[model samples]
Target: MGMGMGLGLGSNMQQNNSKEWVKDASDAQKGVNEILSFEEYVALAEKRPCLECRPSCKYIKDIFEYFGKSPRGDYNLFIKESANSTAVYGQQRVYEHIYQNILNFTEEGFNNKFILLVGPNGSAKTSIVRKLMEGAEEYSKCDNGALYSFSWIFPIESYIKGTLGFERRGEQKESCSSQTYAYLEDREISSILSSELRDHPLLLIPASKRQQMIDTWLKAFPSELETVRKSYLYYGDISKRNRMIYDALLQSYQGNLAEVLKHIRVERFAISKRYSVGAVTIEPQLHVDLRIQQITMDRRLATLPPSLQSLNLFSVQGENAMANRGILEFSDLLKRPLDAFKYLIMTMESRTINLQGILTELDIFFIGSSNEIHLSAFKQHPDYYSFRGRINFIKVPYLLNAEEEVKIYNDQIASLKSKMNFEPHALECLCLWAVMTRLRPALAKNYKDKKLGELVTTLNPLEKALLYSNEFLPARLDSEEKKLLKVSIQDVIREFENENLYEGKFGISPREIKQIIYEISSKGLMVTFVDILDFLNKFIDRKNEHDFLNIAPQGDYANPVRFIELLKDYQLEIFDHELRDSLNLVDDRSYEGYLIRYVQNITSLIKGEKIKSQITGRYEDIDHFFVKEFENNIKLKESPEIFRSHMMTTLGAYSLDHPNKKIVYTEVFTDLVKTLKESFREEQKKVIVNIAKNLVFYLSEVEDPEHKRSSSLSEEGRKEIEIVLEKLQGKYRYSQAGALTLARYLIKEKY
Candidate 1:
């Protein structure tokens, strides 16, 4: 689906702003840790009141139990849903409008009942909504993202300020133990307090909490201290001036308790959480809630809102008025009618839903959309007053303008040309035609009437090309104009077939539309002032294949059984340049030259494999030898002229003027006699003199007979053979082998 295509929209959906809120937290567990002195350790522990409780409640569990929204009953965090995302439409202040409207449900200042986005499709209406919620984070100036903590940020500071109150210290530990809260036996307590009580009698009791201590602890402490007060910490009255220390310690302990409670409450400040971005997420539970109230859906229209004659269900008299609801989706909005607008309007008005015995007044936000339908419903009945100012229309416009169309087509052509060559105008005309006619229906399909919390562009940029190539051009059009063009072009193509598509005149075919357009555009026929009438008819039928070789025998004609005896004497040809030479009788090419192309058009139907396949089957092995043989013989021994000409055509090089050809001849011309002798063509010498001059050179290099092989004799061997060949052929003599004429003439047998 190419990223954003399959899900009814393009895959490269823009990332939303609040994404940070849900992103995984950093690995703090693997970071640094710290240790502190006894007193410092106590103080540091006091700072994090969050450690006191859990996710639901940071400190005071009782408070969390009363208001938290978790199954655990301890976490006060609300994991519910709400439409609190804030979207900004490229600074158009659109998201602010949606936020303002949703807020109006609870915030009385701007009590707007319905908020709408009225604009052309693709004008960023939905983008604005998404931007509000999941928008560009760089601008938010918040690096970490929206952080929500249910625990106090600074608990220690809050406690010290008296914002959290506590008074009086408790009994202290008396045992000579290492732990803070050791046993408080009479014997140990007496030893521990002896120093403080004697030095500072006043420290034994604080004026404020002194009376309660006397009644609650003093009487029973002496006898029961071992069992009941086995563990305790003494913070007050430890010395001659310990009285002051005792009072201070008691006050500090009381303060710590109060701070812990406040820390728990402050961390859970959902009581006042607000959106820093436009997107507010509701959990699955909320979506489920909305679905529960919706009626069963049917195929044609997802069923209608359950009230037309029973219309009172939405007014003030109705229990669930249209004043409170969560949402109004514009699902398949374009498929509905323009006049069937009343239900959509009701959804937009503030509404409520009655579910299970609970009269839930939800702030229903609405989305309504439809392509041109139901316009008459508004006029057909005088009583049809369903539509008000609720629907916000976003019109999807036509495909590209002429200029954009050109840009699109050019982009596609440039992309394709690098991999597979095509004449520039050839691709252009095809795309231009489609843009002008075929893409109309696709552009028209997305039009719908309704607004959303956010909107997105789901269309792909390449769909036009794919659809036209595979579906529309071949199957859809049956128009008179198209039919006429096919008939006219068919006649021309038939004439060419009768004469085997003449040498000078261009062949006509459906593929010619693009080429002809290119020719017209490039001034090939100088038709600058002429208009093409019925162009489709003037070209060939795109449907048919050339039929001349349709009836040929299918096999290697060398095998008598495979050959039609009547055709044995006829000559044939080969086309694949890799298998033949390039001096095609006709100079049809890119000014570079022409191809010998396939001669005799050796068409075949092979259910089994042959030598080419065999050679191809072990191509790697054969290739190793082929390359060695070509370099040693074909590249070295052949007269520079033969090598240059043969190699040039093999690579699709048409003109002998190629610089590589020049380099080959420059390096290999050994004798003027041999070079000049090879140049004498049929026109220069009808008798074909020194045809032996070329033959001896070609045959001298041939080591394999089944395949004319180029095998360069090695240094030691060359000197040895050079003596024999030279004596037999004479100096500055011996012709090249595998006649370009005969070789080109015979390769037709194989293909």
Candidate 2:
């Protein structure tokens, strides 16, 4: 038994000392293909060192580019449908600002500032940051978005397989390429010492020697150089643990830097906000704890060689520390005592933090968010000026466009893992109310001295929302007024930005609106527009507690209740139009055809060209009578021929500028369409009244509990109502409630 034990011990020792390293296919691929060597990393750094220095914005811009970007006045990309994604609506301007700032910061070396998003609660400040972090984390896992870190590959025989007889540690060999590390396949990696800081691999070199190497490399590629100082080359230091390991390896190698690098292993890493791999979120609390963590007194750690054991390597972790080399989000930044984060002034300027007397450097983008109340208070503080230059404040406000606002609720509804039915316009009703509460009346005082005053005075919140969305202009406006409104839109938006109380600065937040929807759904009641309206009405009653409720506008849209009434009136107008269409007695398609023919006739008359007549089936001179009839409806100040000539000139100029696009005549003469619709509505009034009477009879008969006799309709009456209802559903996308509402509106308006 004693002989057998001795033989077993000898066998184990032999295996440990002389075992061959059959390379792991997965690990080899990860190392050789996924990760870049020090030399390769340097080559990339020379061409695009911004990847290492400004990784946050670089990765963010990569995400932006991956999704794609649009020019300032173009918002189609921000709201386009994707197969598997919800469009990011209403923040195109914000995106442009952020993207442009990042470009300037990276290309122009504007790195001495932190981006701070300030807004009221629930204005998508945190949401924007969350998306950016998610995008960055997702991108970091890709080969194209690869980030790197290094580990000390110690020559411990028990952990390693090869390098049995290598006495000189610095015996370098020729690399396969000038951009790769020296060949050292015979010396397999053993103990991998990781770093929590994820410091740059270049930091492995001594400070003085690294600077000299960078200078020499830059000199070799003068064309790649820029006027901006390359301060980022020396941005951060190695973590204390890595520093200790590096020092120990250097000492063991008798102060030979090249020999020390022989024990290094380059690795590929991914960013994870949850694990604090490359991103982290910090609250205002005292959660930034950084203390020395002792190594576990387990066999693996205890059995370390005396050389490493003597170094007493320990790990430290904190919010800022974990977020090194990536992003650090200070959530609700101003919620805490300003003194707690006063070090930001220094950190932003120098990109370093004092960690228990050790000056730790960082290569991280710091993002902070604050509510308007806190920011307003912060602005009054004396220390505001002290931290001004280091911070760039971007205001995040509630969506001004009701259409865009509806998308928020729509997205939320789609995400709910529930199967509840929402009545059409329930979300729209809620969104519109929330938007109304947020809008500031166009301040006459601000624009009164300017030429935009008259237009601004006439603009209500609803009209302003339409303008902001670029959806539609006021249909009642004259051609000249419409032209002026379109031209001054940017100036109006700029005025809103400069307003003391910005248009979107005050409101019942989307969060509050979402909660109301949740409550309505949870009650198992029909989530109707009326129910949402009632919820908003009740919300207004709680104005004593919510300060935003007290923000009354200076126009007809002064109060939330008044705004709700205005919305109902607007809806009623819409209902009337829908009801006229729903009766299915008048043909709108015929009217549209007539309008198209009228335009063709006018065009031919102005050009003195012959036209084909649909009624006569003959080529004839342009119909002056039909053209004059449409022209009279337009109420043009110019004579009919002059008006026709002007329209032709406008169309000709438009066609010349937009050669690929066809000129839309209806868009140019929107008022004519409105006049036609109004004329058709007058013609259909009797049919609408008859339908309304039957609808009211149908509802009252079905709803009456006291009626003993059966409530019945004649076959012809039922057929008429059924045909109209079908048209309402199939053509107009109206629900049963919507049909009933429109019918009631028609009854009130016509009957």
Candidate 3:
């Protein structure tokens, strides 16, 4: 009975599997049937006129969704799931420039110019173009971004002679009344001639008649008609090969356009970088990008009609032809000799490539990349002016913001995390040092506001890096000055944007940082911030090897060695905070609450109003003594009255700036928070020192088990050390070994 039940279950499963397999096969058949006849394609065009003849720029714009404008005025092209998930971070200005150019191309018709991405080496110039191509390829797989092209289908000799009336007998027999032989079996077809140029299917129609039909269909979409009219569809003709076949068929059919189009097959094609269908990349090689060859000698076409066989049919075959209807990238374009690519001067402007005097029309977006050195040399050439008008340059600089720089490291760290452990801020310290090397000291006189300008001039490399990241305000500035600098951050960023030597142009590239990270991770030990700093220090000693390290110091910038020192100091501050937090002396949230309460009291005092205390639950005068005590703790430099007035002004401005939003006191009063933290650290200096010493002692004993028995640690001290180590591991994601290393570092250097 059990065996019979098992057989019944197995039979049911088999039936269910058969049903699923049938459904999948049906879906596959539906996909195969998506290739439409010429008439069906026209019908589709009527339904979606804009999508049918959308320009490359519009197609790219459709691939990425607009994610609103960033705070820096850069338009965010949000990386959608469909766009192949390639993310280019921290190049907002570059994206915004490209987006604007795309808009211009879409609105102003074909720009007849190449989009050139120029940058220093190790920047993401190639990555940006690759991302766009990848997005285009993925977009083509969808119905909305579907691209259509045409091919010539020649039936078997018997069918062509009898059914297609190629024999021109007294009476023509129609064995097949179908408009197209596109669905004919491969065995039944003699030749299927596809264009390497991937000519648009609509190009088969006479230009005038095509325009008339498109206009009629596009009347319903009046807004899109203008754009469609500007595209290659409205202007481009069939390739030379297709044109020859079309003309021969028209003559054979006695000017019956319908009969000629009957031999035309319209199929949906996808852009594929892998297959070199429409997206192509050309390396720096001394070879012609385009060429043509005669196809009449091929045995496959020996069965062709006398009319087509008599003509010398040449096929366009090259990178330029393969990249038709999509993007073509020239990697390190300037690396090639000037004479090699000089054809670009005319090709870019005319939208055609000359192959042995035969001009093949192109509808492709040309993109090229070159490093600063190559581009600089190219600029010195006499032909620079000749090509200048045909090129649009967009700069891709190394990331200046440490926060964005850290993102690149974090991605690398994520993969290494399972292999080993990382102490808190390990990657952050490296990113900070790299960004510091990229910053340029600000010129006080360059600022429109003299006070703000002087404050800008005072900014060190670390301070500028932090400002660019929007992470922290410089601690030296008061609240109002801090506000000025905060508001002027965008201006500060763009101060040298138009200049040839920009701040981000000379940074230690993220590539080097990743190499450093991998080298450290390969040790198979706990990675600490000190390990990163030490590695960078040793790396910088080879100044002759790295150009950025050899750069002369400009005030507090461009000094790689000094930047390491600054990073060490910054790490000490981080360690002090972490150690204090582990001891539960003063957590940020509690301190923030205390600061908020103090601000509230001060505001009431200035307004001459009573304050309702949460503890007292009664209206009372402002607590002047409590306010003074808090002010003294932070060591307010200004008088109490002036300090209170500045505080009121800051609060008022914040309220106005962020209407209906709850105030985050710590964020608004960053300088105050820094000062308060410093004051707290100074007050508990002795206790922190004692704890560090105990942590070092405990870790040393743990490492040497023999010393553990003779250790002089009291029971309370031992428990405290254990709690700190536990908190470090659990709260901060530090492994036991990492925490122990940090404890030793702090005791030796920071304490």
Candidate 4:
């Protein structure tokens, strides 16, 4: 019976898995159909049409925005987050600039220029490009993101000499159409020809006659279709091999255009950098070859029509050929010899490259990345000025905000295949120290006013980090300046920018941090903040071995140990606050009740009227003593009536500012809670310190196994310690060890 039940369960599980698999397959097939003939494609295009007379850059931009949402500004399809899935941290400015340039190219046409991303090593230049290519590939598979290409269909009538038999294979049925023949036994079969370049089928029409044909076709269309027709009018010509096939087919058809068009088979295609389908990445290699091949030896070619059999049947293949109609990324484009890549400048401008003396037309967007060092060196080259116009340079720098930097680490940790324990703030502490190394001292001259100048001069790396993260403005600024700071922060960040001393241009890269994390985890030990700091200190010690570490930040930031201490202090402050809050020393409910009671009594005092008391069920005058106690708690030292009037006025102004929203007392009086917490902590200082000391003593006494000893506490002592322990664990969510650690740290600080 057990065996039967197990079999039944296994069978049910298999059925459920198969159902899920089938559903996924159906969903995948619904999005895109990968095959289509010329007529079918033209019909699809007519139904779902593009109405923009712009370059391929517009299409590229559209593809980018299709997969990602826009950033802050209210612009159409302007993506601020460029690193869609690649997890590039904190380079929104660079992404926005690159996006704007791509949009500019919609009006500029083919300028023979490439978007050159320049940054320091390990600054995620390659990551940005990979994300873009990945997005394009995904976008192409979507309905609105459709792209089309075609392959040649060579009829094979000569294979069996017209002797054919029909047979059924499985449940398949043969359908005959003008574009394709129905074949069962193979005598009337046609060999489907493939092109390496994946040329668009419309390119079969010669450029001289293509414009007139498109214009005549456009005239029959609705007025709304004009833009798409006009934009497509500027499409590139066919490849050399496709041109050869075209010439042979035209000769065989006796120059009949309609007959030649009959063999054209349009196929739907998507961008794939991995498969080299329309998206290609080229590295500097010894051989730079883009050539056409003749296939006269294949048995398939022998079966072709006599006109095609005698003539050379050609197909093009290479990096340049495969990347046609899409994107070609030149990785570390400047790493190659100048002579090797020099042709790009001319090819970019003319939209044509002379390959083996053949003038090939290219309708592709070019992108490349290079380290800033190489880019700087290349800028000094005599040919730099000539190539400058053909390149759009963008800077991808390390992240300035520690919070965003932490995101990079968090994402990496999430992607790890194995489970590893990480102490709280382990990643955050690393991010803090890493970001510190990247910051430059704020120059006083960058500010406009003397006060602002002084503020800028005193802007330590920590404060600058907070500013970059938009966490808080320093208290030194006035109310108006504080408001203005948020708007002008971006400008402040770029104020002292230079080729060598930019804020984010220098730092320990995320790659190194990831390596450190890996090394720590390899020991099979749980990683803590202290462990990470120790590893980082060791890494910094070997500064002479690595270039980036050797080039330290200016002044106080030059010492790695000092920076670690700063991070420690920051973490300690957070722990102290949590410790104080966990004690339940500040009663928010009590404070709110008192505040409401005071507001009521003061209202009565200000109005010179008596209020009915719920306690006595009788009318009574405002109790000055009761009101004064509430006032003293908040340190509101003024005339009680005036204080009450001021509170009402403050709420009124807040209501005006946030219309239609309820007035929140805590939000309006933020400093009031802070002041209350301070006062309460002072009142219970001795009690808190004593509890912290006793907890440390208890843990220390019981921690050892061999010397296990009783804590020797009275019933009240045990209850008191347990109360604080429960608050720490339940309220603050601290583990037993974490609670112990907090106790020890608190005892040392006596708070």
On lDDT, the leading prediction is 3
How big is the RMSD of model 2? 8.4
Question: Which residue pairs clash within candidate 3?
Answer: none
Q: Scored by Cα lDDT, where does model 2 land?
A: 0.67
Q: Rank the candidates by lDDT, best first.
A: 3, 4, 2, 1
lDDT of 4: 0.68
**2 versus 3: better TM-score goes to:** 3
lDDT of 1 by residue, 83-174 (tens): 44322112212333443344333222112244344332233334343332222222122311211211111212234353222211243323
Off by over 4 Å in 2: 1-56, 70-88, 108-110, 157-192, 205-229, 234-248, 287-315, 415-420, 444-451, 522-531, 585-588, 591-593, 600-628, 631-646, 657-664, 700-714
lDDT of 4 by residue, 475-499 (tens): 4443345545656786678875654
* Model 2: per-residue Cα lDDT over 1-751, one tens digit each: 9999999999998876655343454554563345445665667766755454344445555666765645645334345554433456687667677777777555544355778898788888777777667666766766557778775555546423443323223444344223122223334433456667777787776777766666665564442233123445443458777887777767876886666665555677777877887778988786543445656453445444456776655666777777776778899999889887888888777766777666666667778899988988999999999988888888888887788788777866775536565766667767777777776666666664454677677877767766776546786665556666777777777777855578778877777777877877776535556566666667778877778777655665657777777666666666566666666544545665676787789877766789987799888987788877776655555566655665666667778988998666566556666667776667677776666777777766557768665666666776777787787778767767556655655576547
Model 1, 404: alpha-carbon shift in Å? 4.3
Which candidate wins on TM-score?
A: 3
Clashes of each: 74, 0, 0, 2
* lDDT of every model, 2 decimals: 0.27, 0.67, 0.79, 0.68
Measured against the true structure, the TM-scores of the candidates, in listed sequence, are 0.24, 0.81, 0.91, 0.81
